[model samples]
Target: MDRMSAQKRRESVIRAAIAEFARTGYHGTSTAAIAKRVGVTQPYLFRLFPDKKAIFVAALMRSMDDTRLAFERADDGMEGGGQALRAMTGAYAHLMSTCPETLLMQMQGYAAVAAAEAQGDDLIGEVVRAGWMRIWETVHLSLGADADETASFFACGMLGNTLTAIGLPASAGR
Candidate 1:
C-alpha cells in the first residue's frame, strides 16, 4: 500500500473534520474524533492542524467555498438578474439536497461563532464572517449588484437553512 503524502493526509483530515463538526459543533467535537475518522493518530492530525479550531476553520471555509462555487457555476453564461437569481436558487437547493453535510457544517459553524463571541473569543467569528462575505460577494455580483435583491436572496436562503436545521421538509407548507 502506498503511504499517503502529508498534503493528502491533510485533505483527509479536513474531510473528516467536516463530517465530525457537522454532527457536533466545534465545542462538542474532539481532535481525537477527527483523527480517528481520518484513520490518523492525534499527533498526525496536530501536525496537519495546530488544533481543533484550526480544523474547524478549514472545514467552515471549505463549506463556504463550495457554496460560492455553486452560485458562480449557476450564474455562468446566464444573463439578467432574474435569471441568475433563479439559477442560483436552484443550485442552492440542489446543494442542500446533495451535500447536506455542507449545510450542516455551516449551521454548526454559525453556532460555534455565536458561542465564541459570547465568550469574548472573536477568532472563529472573524474567520466565519470573512468566509460568509466571500459567498455574499459572489451572490451579490451574480445578481447584478443590487443590494436589495442580494439581501432578499440571502434572507430567503437563511430561512431555508433555518427550516432545514429544524428538520422541516421543503414541502412542509404544501
Candidate 2:
C-alpha cells in the first residue's frame, strides 16, 4: 500500500479524532480508537500528532475552520445583513442536520477546555475561547455589526443546539 503524505495523514487523523471525540468526548476517547478509525497504528497516530491532546486540539481547529468557511460561503454574494443572516442561519441548520458530529465535537471541545483549565492547563482554554470569539465575530459581521442583533442570533443558536443535543422531537417546539 502506498503511504499517505504526512499532511494528509494528519488531516485524516484529525477527521477521525473529531468523530471519535464527538461520540466519547475527550476523557472517554483514546488515541488507539482514533488510530483504529484512521486505519493506522497508535504509534503512527502519535507520529502524526505529538499526543492525544495535540490531536484533539487539531480537531478543534479544523472544526472552527470548517464552520467559518461555511458561514463565509453562505454569506457570499448576499446583500444586506438580513439576507446574510438568513443565509448563515440556514447554512447552520443544514450543517446540524448533515454534519451533526462536528457540532457535537465542538461541544466536547468546550467541555475539554474547562476540564483542562481545572487541571492548570489554560492553553487549550485560551485557544478554544479564541476560536469561539472568531466565530462570534464572523456572525456579528454577517448580521450587520449590530451588537443586540448578533447577541440575539447567537442566543437562538444556542437554544437550537441545546434542543438538538437533548434529542428533543421536532414537534417539541409546537
Candidate 3:
C-alpha cells in the first residue's frame, strides 16, 4: 500500500471495509476497525469516506458490481440458454466458496437498506437497490429476458447466501 495515490488508498479502504463489514455487518463493524485493516488511522478513513455509512455503501456497491461481473464473464459472447445459466450458476457457486465474505456482505446490505428505509431514510436503500438492480438486470438479460427465470435465479441466490451466512450447507437435509 506504500506510495499509492489517494484514489488507490481509497480503493484499498473500500476493500478493507468489505472484509470487515462482511464479518460484522453494517452496525456491528466500526470505522476504526476498517482503518486498522487498511493500516491507516480512523481519521484518515474519514478523509477517504464521509462516515461509516458511506463506507458501508461503498463496500455494498462494490460487492454487487463484482457479482455482476461474475455473471457477465460467465455468459460473455454466448447465446442466452440453459447452458449459459448453468455456467453462471457454476461461476456463482465458485464465488461463494472462495469469497464467502462477499456473500455475507450481500446479506448485510439487504438488512441495512431495509432498516434504513423503515426509519424513513431511503438514500441508502436507493443506492443499494440501484446496485442490486444492475445485478438483477444482468441476470435477467442473460437468462433470455424471462422475468420468472430472472426472479427464480435471484431467489435461489438469496437462499444460498442466507444459508452461507448462517453457516449451513446448501443441502441441509439428508
Candidate 4:
C-alpha cells in the first residue's frame, strides 16, 4: 500500500484506535493492537500518538468532532431548541442503534469529562459545553436558559441518553 499523508495517517490511526477501543474497552486496547489494525508498527503508532492514552484522546476528539457536526447539521432550518434537539437526538440515536458498540467511545468521552470536572480540566467538558452553547444560541432567551443553565440541561439531557437510545424502536431515530 502507498504510504499515507500525515493527516491521513493520523486519521487512519484514530479510526483504528476507536475500533480497538470500542471492542476492547479503553484499558484492554493495546498500542500493538491499534498499530496492527492500522497496518503499522507499534513505533509508528507511537509516532502518531505518544501512548494508548493519547490514542484514546485522539479518538475521543474525533468522536466529539462528529458529535458537533451532528448538532450543526441538525440546526439547519430547525426553528428552536426543541426542534434542533430533536434533529440532533435523532442523528445520535440512529448512530446508537446502528453501532451500539460506539457507546464505548461515548463512555470514554464522558469519563474524560467527569475527570476534567473534578480537576478543573476544561478541555473535555468544553466539547459538551460548546455543542450545548450552540443550542442555547439557536433557542435564544425565550427558552429561559442562560448559558450555564442551558449547558447543564444539555449535558444532563441529550448527552445522557445517547447510549440508552440503543435498542430503541426504529421510530426513535426517525
Instruction: State TM-scores per candidate.
Output: 0.92, 0.93, 0.93, 0.66
TM-score of 2: 0.93
- Measured on C-alpha atoms, candidate 2 has an lDDT of 0.83
User: lDDT per model, in order?
Assistant: 0.87, 0.83, 0.87, 0.64
Give the higher-lDDT candidate: 2 or 4.
Answer: 2
* Residue 145 in candidate 1, Cα distance off native in Å: 1.1
> What would the per-residue lDDT of candidate 3 be over residues 73-128, giving only the tens digit for each residue?
99998789797799898888888888888778877888898799999989778877
Model 4: per-residue lDDT, tens digit, 148-167? 64565456445445425343
How far off is residue 128 in model 3, in Å? 2.1
Write the residue-wise lDDT of candidate 1 on 23-111 in tens digits: 88887899999988889899988899998888999998888888989999999998748999999999998987778778889989888
Clashing residue pairs in all predictions, respectively, total: 0, 0, 0, 0
RMSD of model 4 against the true structure? 4.9
**What does each candidate score in C-alpha RMSD?**
1.6, 1.6, 1.7, 4.9
Tally clashing residue pairs in candidate 4.
0
In model 4, the Cα lDDT at residue 62 comes to 70
Q: Candidate 1: misplaced stretches above 4 Å?
A: none
- Runs in model 3 lying further than 4 Å from the true structure: 171-174
Query: Worst 10-residue stretch by lDDT in candidate 4?
Result: 165-174
